[model samples]
Target: MATTKTVDLILDAGMALVAGAGPDGASVRAIADRAGVSAPAVQHHFRAKESLLHGIYARAVDCHLEVTAAALLPVVLPHAERVAEPARQGVIVEMATSVMQEWLREEGRATLTSVILHLLVHAVRDASYGDLASRWLAGTVTAFESVGVAGTGDAQFLVELLIGAALVSAPGRFRCENDILNRELFRSACGARDWDGGFWLERYRTRHERTRPDSDPSGEGEGLYARLLDVCVALTAEVGADALSYRKIAARAKVAPSSVLYHFPNRTGLLMALYREVHRRFMLAAGTEEVEPRAQAAPAAGLFAKLIVDEMAGEAPLFLTSCELFLASWREMELAPDALFMRLERGKMHGVPQLSPSERQRAHLHSIWSLGLALTQYSHASSHRSRDVELRLRDGMRFLDD
Candidate 1:
């Protein structure tokens, strides 16, 4: 019989492999090898690959939720006592940030989150998983309420936001440039003393300009092209790519169907154009044109993360729109290529201070510290407490370092 320690060893190895290569990558044979066990030995312990995966998934969810609870416990206590003054609020924010950074640094958490996301996508399609999922969600909300944050709706929103952030920042996975927006939101929530919206807006505009395809600079093709792009994006967000028709876009854009065809010519052309437009906007929103791009980019990333949490916590329409976009992109990979480009650009644009390979890794580690800190905005479960969402945004720009 496998010792308890041996079983844990196998599970740990399996999780590591899954973290690096995803669930598909963690083959039973590979896991067995990693665990220094024969294939049959591995099977003896896990019975089946699905069972092993379920174990890992359950652990990951529990671990993350535990970390989340630990982080929020102090904040909730003070808020419950009605002693959440500005200084106390600041401490709570800092504490939340620190806990988030810690969570992000934990590779297990990231891997588990990825696995959970995989499960969630499949669960949404499978009715059999409904009861299990509902139970999980309910338990999660109850946990938050127990810690002082109140309301099931608020808890659900925050959970979705955290899940969305995990989805967006899944290591080695693809995500939209909207991550910048998420980061900006985090900074805003953290009580930064010098948040600057104009700075982010300008950076967004510059990024947009860089990615836009060369067009008739004379402005002849600009209007029709712009309208077509807008309509396609709107429709894509509305009914998804398969349901998007030129006729629908024309109706939404209030342009004639003939005008839409005049610019796009075909569905492929329209899809491509729409895809390009989303990337263009994402780059514009996420790129750095500021003199100190990394410095600027870091805060923006933080702020954007916070905003996502706040909006999702409120169950706002914009959050729903963003979620739809995220889900649609999964089905239409073409619409979501921006995630890859954004990751590359972030690495390149932020590649300054001339660090060695190890140093670069360390810097990335530090950036991820902020990344996790930014994610805490999504873990709270109080809609009334979230009234400070805009306040957090205002405070974010206040702390921009030179």
Candidate 2:
């Protein structure tokens, strides 16, 4: 609307730029120019660039959650009297499909939805996102609770599944890969079962049916732990963390479920171990550099920049799935792997004599923010302009200042 306020215009412009050119495109000048306003106007509305990015992130989250749910409601409500609650879940496939198709029809919404998803999976690693994420998720939890949908043992989990499925499957990005995600999420919402194993796991299992599950013979299970972790990580890359199961893990490891459980006991044990393995590898990659001493001497930013390039280039899937697990844990109110790992790592980083308390905190936030931006950039189909990425990197460097 022409009458839209300055902040809203800036948010819209920022979202548009991100959608078109990835995280690198959301520069202050670009957003300001798109909004037909001076750079000062952008700063006037949102003082810091970080705050502006958060504005875009928050707006995108709100828009997707509200719009998608609203779209679903209208269709479901029309037949409210005729269909029973149990029956509603089964019959609403067509309704859900229509809602999804409608979501795909609008490029603006689709882009915004993807951007919000990017934020949810990455920006959330920052402590600054805690209040915002909690507040938004609280509302989401309430909405799902009120629905009283059958077969939803955990309303919060279903809420997350719905959001993830809708955004990941949003039209045009990766259609063929996401179709199963969309269908399974729809069925699960209404009252389907085994959503975790429904389509994603089944597909993976079916394709790899030739690889049958077996137990280690002759009491020779020396490298079982490492093999299991590797298989779990690979499976996580293919299907999401939420879709993982002990059976799936065992199936891929080519071991009896009991053999896999011998090391991990339970699914949580397996996942936590898998998480730690991923973290260990990431730390080694980020910390180990054969380059000049200058790169290593600089604070977190330099190492993070190099790590971003490395992760995006060859480690894309691992980085992608790792972030997905981090994000899912954050949503479910479980202790995040980063939360635990950072505690140990933070103590090491704090050994620097010059760092202040406030500076330390900012650095922590900056580290998380950088990872989120890197993840967002990796998820995109292409890179934004060089100037755009440089602007983001330059502004981020300011956080290193005490």
Best by TM-score: 1
Cα lDDT of candidate 2 equals 0.52
Per-residue lDDT over 1-402 for candidate 1, one digit per residue giving the tens place of the 0 to 100 score:
547877877777876775555555679999889988888987887898877876665565666567666767766665664333355434434443443444445445555554444445434334343444454555656655564433444343334434544544534333234444344434443334443432442354346543445442335668767766765665554333443667777887788888777776665455445545554553344443431333444455454444334322111312223333333343344544543333223323342455444333222222323222232332233354334443433243333221
Stretches > 4 Å off in candidate 2:
1-4, 22-24, 75-88, 91-104, 146-154, 173-177, 188-402
Best by lDDT: 2
- At residue 13, give the lDDT of candidate 2: 89
Q: Show how many residue pairs clash in every candidate, following the order shown.
A: 30, 0
CA-only RMSD, every prediction: 12.8, 20.0
Query: How big is the RMSD of model 1?
Result: 12.8
Residue 361: error of model 1 in Å? 30
Worst 10 contiguous positions by lDDT, candidate 2: 342-351
Question: With candidate 2 superimposed using the best TM-score fit, by how many Å does residue 216's alpha carbon deviate from the native?
Answer: 27
